[model samples]
Target: MNFQHKTVIITGAANGIGEAIAYGYAKEGARVVLADIDEEKGKYLEEQLRKGSYEAYFKKTD
Candidate 1:
C-alpha cells in the first residue's frame, strides 16, 4: 500500500526486527520515527535512510 504522508513510529529501532520494520515503512514512503536508547546506531540508521531519500528520524528514549 502507498504510505506516502503516513507516519510510523518504531521502538528498539537501532537494530534487528525494529530496524527492519523501519526500513519497510520508509521504503513504502512512510515517514519513520525510530525510538531507541542506542543513540549512535539510531542516528546512523537515520542518516542512512536519509541518504537513500527516505524520511526518517531518531529519538533516544528508554
Candidate 2:
C-alpha cells in the first residue's frame, strides 16, 4: 500500500505489466527503479514520472 521512503526495482518495466507496476509504486511514494532492455521506453517513462514529481529512474538491462 503505502510505499513512502521505499525503493522498488522493477524489471521489464518499459512496458506492459511491469510498466504499470512501476507507475503504481512511484505514485505510492516509492523511489522507482525501472530496469528494462528497451532503453528508449524505459528512459521515456522515467522522464514522464519525473515530470509528475515522482522519484523514478531507468536502467538499461538484458
Candidate 3:
C-alpha cells in the first residue's frame, strides 16, 4: 500500500473501473501513468490528479 516512489501504468484509465483504479493509485501516493485511447478524458483525469498534487501523466495509446 506504500507507493511513495512507485509508478503504476494503467490502461483504459480514461473512465469507469480503470479511472477509479487510477485514483486509487494516486491516493496511495503512486505516480500514475494513464494509458488510453481517449485523449480528452485521459488528459482531464491527468489534470484532475495533478490539481490534487498527485503525480499523474496521460499517454495516448491504442
Candidate 4:
C-alpha cells in the first residue's frame, strides 16, 4: 500500500518473519525501526536497507 510517510516498528528483526516485514515496509517507503537482540545481524540488515535507499535503524531489545 501507501507508506510514503509512515513509520513502522518491528521486533525480532534480526532474521525470518520480522526481517521480512521490515523489508516490506521499507520497500513501501516507510521508515522502519528494527528491534532485535542480535546487534550484528540487526546492524547488517539496517545497512542493507540503507544501501537500498530505505530509512531503517536497529535497536537492541534484549
lDDT against the true structure, each candidate: 0.97, 0.95, 0.98, 0.96
Collision count for each candidate, in order = 0, 0, 0, 0
Q: Per-candidate TM vs. native?
A: 0.97, 0.96, 0.98, 0.96
Give candidate 2 misplaced runs (Cα > 4 Å). Answer: none
lDDT of 2 by residue, 1-62 (tens): 89999999999999999989998899899999999999999999999999999999899999
Give the best candidate by TM-score.
3
TM-score winner between candidates 3 and 4? 3
Error of 3 at 24 (Å): 0.3
lDDT of 3 by residue, 1-62 (tens): 78999999999999999999999999999999999999999999999999999999999999
Give the TM-score comparing model 1 with the true structure, all chains together. 0.97
In Å, residue 8's CA in model 2 sits off its true spot by 0.2
Q: Is candidate 2 or candidate 3 better by lDDT?
A: 3
Error of 1 at 11 (Å): 0.4
Summarize candidate 4's per-residue lDDT along 1-62 as a digit string, tens digits. Answer: 98999999999998999999999999999999999999999999999999999999999998
